[model samples]
Target chain A: MQIRKFHVYLTLVMFSTGFLMASSIELTQSTKKSRENENELQQEMSLNERIIAEREKNRSLEIQSLDRQRDISKIEEELAKHETDAAGLLANLEEARMLAGTVPAEGAGIVVTLRDNPSSNSQNVIQNIVHEQDIWRVVNELYAAGAEGVSVNDQRLVTSSSIRCVGPTVIVNGVKSAAPFVIKAVGDPDTLEAALHLPGGVVDVFDGFIKIESGKKENIQLPAFLGDAKVGKSVS
Target chain B: MGQNRKITFILTTISAIIGVMLAVQLQSNLHPLQSESRSITELRKVLLQEQEKSKVLLADISKQEQLLSQYQESLDSVDSIGVMKEELSRAQKQAGLASVSGKGIIIQIEQDPILNEQWDAENLPLPDPSNLVLDVDLRWLTNELLANGAQVLSINNNRLLSNSSIRNVGEKIQVDTKTIRMPYEIKALGNPDTLISSMKLEGLEEFFRSVNMKVTIEERENLVIPAFNGTKHIQHMKPIKAKGDS
Candidate 1:
């Protein structure tokens, strides 16, 4: 029995040592590779830190702009309150601004999200990625179904709005955004949802390609158009 | 037996050392990105994104400041209503609710006879003259014109509004919810030279030529795009109550 116990203990020690040696070899190679790339790693890390800092600063600036916008709205409300004749004018102006997408909007609507196919392979990259045409198709369906307001990735659709393809990303209202484009529409949620699922509509067209999803939301808030809305001064 | 014990003791100690080393290696692997970062290109992408956002945010700040001062001036001035009218007109123009005229280009896309795509080796059903210039094509055309400085646009007399959509419904193409049949006339109120040059650069003219689309881009001395006559409402989108919140 003592001899048997000794054999088992020796085997256990040998097995563990063998496993450890294999792992150590693997680890050493990777560690060496990492050491070789240490300089690049350091540079990348610093770059990441700077990006984070820049983003934080932008968030604060965004808030500043939003605050000022709110203040202007409040003053407009005061004016509309005092001047009865101007009430109609202010109301018309607000409607026009809403249609122009110059102001923030929120109400009963639907959100259509298109993301790159999860099973994307290199061979089918074109089919797997979301294109500007796909976005336009969805937007077209929404408007056809009587959507009153629409925005893509928070870039509100305006008269001068154009979705331009720039490499892999699309520029909506002159602001570039990538795939997984969230399209928010303000209208009858049921009508908007039904329009997309029509026979050979956006759903069928994007079938083996992008992942499209449409859902009704009680309230979908879209921001104001941030791009310059001023036309060419030469236009008379 | 004593020899066996000594050998076993040595093995045990060696294994213990190996076990410690393995743990250290595993720990390091677990914290692989403890230094943290993706690729260099990814880092640059993030940096450029922040820069673009910063640019937009800064522009928004100045715009808001300007609007605030204007509102302040109007509120204090006796001609407050007049100033409000100016603001209203500005919004109206931006919304394409007012007529605009300028030196621009007019594009006419008419159908021509063409067999089909060479890529369709099986001779699939025709993407013939009827479906040659779909709404997607029109959208790209519109994008090109607008990107190259087209201020006001109308497709088949249907003003392209902020909420406009070009769509093909049952073989009929519609712009801004109104059916616009083929032989489309797209009018743009902007610099004609810029629009035409950009169209050529996009190879749009060439592509249309190769297909069943007979396209023409002409420089008009004065192109007028009328106000959007379609229903404009704000039923669903209520301007979020800005008050009662910071």
Candidate 2:
């Protein structure tokens, strides 16, 4: 029985030793694998950290680009507004230039010719003559007809031009002019001509005393005001 | 029996070690990432890289802001010049120194037609002065037109301004300083409708009719009024000095 017990103990110890050796071998292989895995994890961790850092930089750059883009668009909008203002001011300047008589004007208008009566009596010459008042009366009628520009005997009549008689000769604008005054006016030709032919208009009133002729001209050109303009002459 | 008990103890210890080894392997396999940890150096490097990039971006932003302020400064200078240009243009328009175009009316008046039928229409002898259009008649017509809202007026081709005159010298008529003749065409710039309506008012039209005079009125869509051509000779009148003027 003792021999049998001894043999069983010896087998148990041998089996325990075999189990310990196998377990030890497995532990060593697992440790080697764990170490290799730790190295790989370290590499992966570094790669992941680099990716995070790059991503943060890209996000910051993207935000900055967006802010700059917004600022550029705002500046562009302001520049466009200023350009439009400049264009409007330039247009106003042109309108003012047109109004100053330094420029010639053209439009539909009328022409009137006046001559001394060829058939009037030689006796009582004063009654038959076309006097200065007769000329003034006709001029006044033209003004009522809405003539924009008026020129008499090729002499452009301006606001300050005056008409008067020095004896038998007529003085106009500080110069002498004879009869058969040809007055050209710029306006609507149809309206201007119609105004002249009224039943008892200036034309008819002078029918027996002076030869009056008038017609509508489709287009007429009036010279620019030759005199200096008082641009700063304020009434106040 | 004691020997048998010793053997049993040895087998129990071996089995306990095997159980612990299996449990450890299973735990590690389930979550490998949790088991792994990063080194401090790697984290520090990532922080340094991000901070450097931020500094560069900050520098770029400040440079852009400086450029924006410079553009704003130029805009202010342009504004002052624009204001001065506008003031000068307004004055030119008001001086009647500028040519103008607008809708208005034209009126024409002539002498008595009876004088045409008979050279001596009134009495027995010569052409009567009463049969002709007198200077008074023209003056009356001009005043009527002014009352009727004629903004700009011209007689024949002579533009009449504030200093214009209509007078009679002998039997002829003088306007401004020039002699004008019959078949007179009067041009007035204003609102066509208002000017025509006011001209046809009762007493004025009735009186013109009673005199056996012929008057014509017509509307024009576009009329060009000439700028004052005469020199600006301000003899009697002088401009008032402003408080700031020397």
Candidate 3:
């Protein structure tokens, strides 16, 4: 009976060993196949990852390009605006220069001449003489009549010009002048003549004492002023 | 039996770990961006930065538009403004806003020295006003100069403008409200030869001789006339706007 029992135990041991070896071999083969499959899956996963990374990179670059384009347009618009501003500034500067009398004036105008009565036999010379008030009256009237430019003896009359007398002679623009005053004005000759010849006008006032003659011409040129372009000074 | 049980336990643990890893790999494969939360956070940051940049750019554009509008206002009516400026400047120069200098003639007037000496000392030649240089006489000369193409004139350093007046205020000659003395000097800027010839043509020299007044003429190549020093106060002038205009 002990021998039979020992034989049975040996059989059981062999059977268990055989079954374990077969299963182990099968498990090894399956593991080897699974390893190959895992490798293929890992490769596919890596490729997908690379594709996703590349797509994300492309999208980011597109967004950056759009932002840059917008910035370029904004800058271009600003540049255009600056160019316009520059043009305006230039225009203003040119205007200022002209107004300051730093440039010459040219146009059509009239010349009015005044002379003392040659036949004045009056014992009182004052009555026969042309007074500063007379010229002033005529000049004021010319301006009133819309004279664009007026000069007495080529001295460009500006807003602050003064006509005065010192003793026997009349001083204008700081120079001495004698009889036969010539007043050149740049304007419509007809308008200036009409303005002077208006009822009870400058001509009427000086009718007896002075001989007044005025006529229009085609071309009149006035020179640039030679005085200091002093700041803070202007004629009303 | 104990050894078999231990082996069984080890195999089961290994299988469980492999299954869990496979599940995680599959999940990652399905959704990459979501599975990697870091990528989502990075993209969100980039988007926010881009949006902020665009916002700043938009603000800049708006600011530029405002500036452009201001510039446009000045640009409007540029041509008319240019013409107006030219006209105004011409008027200003004629009004004596600037000093003028040019080649011209100077006429000097004074009492006749020889005639005064020849006059009887006992009679003292009753200070005849006709013989004396009067304000009216100066005014006549000024008017004559203006008529003869004098652009600017000055009497004894006084600049002549449109409103300057020569008057006799008692014994003193008042020019532009200022009193002046003898040997009056009149400066004029023009063509010197024409001015001299014009005065001669008017017989001014003979006229001066008849009145016992001495006149001397000198032509200068370069003369400077000063600007008007008086103030012009306008009390009743105002601009008129056109209809339907701003």
Candidate 4:
């Protein structure tokens, strides 16, 4: 009976051990398969999230592009408006010019000539001659006298005209003009001449020191206008 | 004994199934993460492109603004000139002025001989009076004439616009890109008697005498002032807009 019991016990132990080993192998294989499936699901989720994010970014970028285009369009419109306004102004200016007719038209006026008096003392008597300031003074007087247009040595006086002193010569519009400086204008001959001949008139001031001749002419020819007027941009 | 073995086998199998599910879930989660990273990177690139485009557009806008300002300025000048012309026309009509053309007076001014003689011999070089015909003098004379009620002033053949500049370059004077000589001729439209009489002020005559300069004033009933020959360039501070249907 003891031997029989021992055999039965041995058989039971072997069977249990074999069954346990098979079951453990099966469990491990099943676990590994399940884990692989889970990983795949997680990967899919990640992909979906990435797609969603990309779509959002794309949408935002598109919106930005649209805004930029809109801005550009607006700016173009402004430019167009500016162009139109400029054209209108030009037209108005032309109309005014037409109404005024040709500038520097015929009128009654006086012609004044200022020059450096030759030295009567000696050949080397270049000591005192007409100074540039004298010319400037005379010109000032003419302007003060209501003289309209002025020209020195045939050079027309424009808005951009510059008169300066270079050595002993008076440079006007880049040209050296020496005495006698002839000034001609077309306006009220009597009134214009009077303006220059007044007590403080440019000509009157230089009368005694310089040779001042006052006369009247039937008609005087004023030169044509020259040069362009450049108007600067407004900051405001 | 058989029953115990069967139970052990069943437990092991269940554990194996659980392990497999876990592994599968982990793998799936990892795939999604990888995909997400790629998508983010792509989105970043798109954002960069958008930023670059915005910058370009901004530059264009800035350039347009500058152009617009320039166009506006031109318009202003045009308006001013128009007003001046209208006023001038009215004044001319009211004055009953007649067209003038012919030879006029030739007034000459020179430095005073006495003054030159008085100069100290030590100051050998004396200032020349012939060098005073510059933009300042011209501008002064022009202003004076305007003040005195004389109209239609022109220098040489160039018409004096409201916006003109007289600058000196080195020793040369430039007026509207044209070079002028000495002995300026000033013309105006007004009453000669009143104008001439107004010029005989005390200081004026005395000043002329002191400088020994000759100033000749001649009145002409008929005088022809020439038109301006300078080019008129289009100037606009702002972009011009199209006009409404004409």
- The candidate maximizing TM-score is 1
Note the DockQ of each predicted structure. Answer: 0.46, 0.04, 0.02, 0.02
Interface RMSD of each: 4.0, 30.7, 28.8, 24.8
Model 2 TM: 0.35
Tell me which of candidates 1 and 3 scores higher on DockQ. 1
Summarize candidate 4's per-residue lDDT along A1-236 as a digit string, tens digits.
54565556666665665665676567657755755576665655665555566556545543443344344334434433666643444444432322222123234556777665564343443423566556555554554444445566665554334465566667665456667677665445676677666675556566445555555554554432222222111112
Q: After superposition, how far is residue A74 of candidate 1 from its true place, in Å?
A: 0.7
Query: Candidate 3, residues B1-246: lDDT per residue as tens digits?
Result: 665555556556655665665566556546543332234345544455445444543453454354334434444444434433443454456556566677888898777878667665556655666456776677678777776677778898787654455666667887765678988888888789999999999887788777766889999987777776655432111111122211
Q: Write the per-residue lDDT of candidate 2 for residues B72-166, one digit (tens) a residue.
A: 55546375334425333443444454556678778876655763456455445654566556668666666556545566677786666633557
Give the higher-TM-score candidate: 1 or 3.
1
Query: How are the candidates ranked when ordered by lDDT, highest leading?
Result: 1, 3, 2, 4
Q: Best by DockQ, which number? A: 1
Compose the digit string of candidate 1's lDDT tens values, residues A1-236: 76777778778877877877797788768875875577886788788889989989987887787788788777777788888867888889889889888778788989999998968544677778887778887987898888989999978888788877778788887667887799999999999999999888889878777899989999988887765666533234
Q: Candidate 4 overall Cα lDDT vs. reference? A: 0.48
Model 2, span A1-236: residue lDDT tens: 86687677668766765776687678657865876666765676676767687767756664664465345335544444667665554344333332333334455778888777757755565656666667666666665555655666755565334455566666554446788777777666777677677787787788767778888786665543333422222222
lDDT of 1 by residue, B15-56 (tens): 788778778878877876454436788788779978887887
Q: Is candidate 1 or candidate 4 better by lDDT?
A: 1
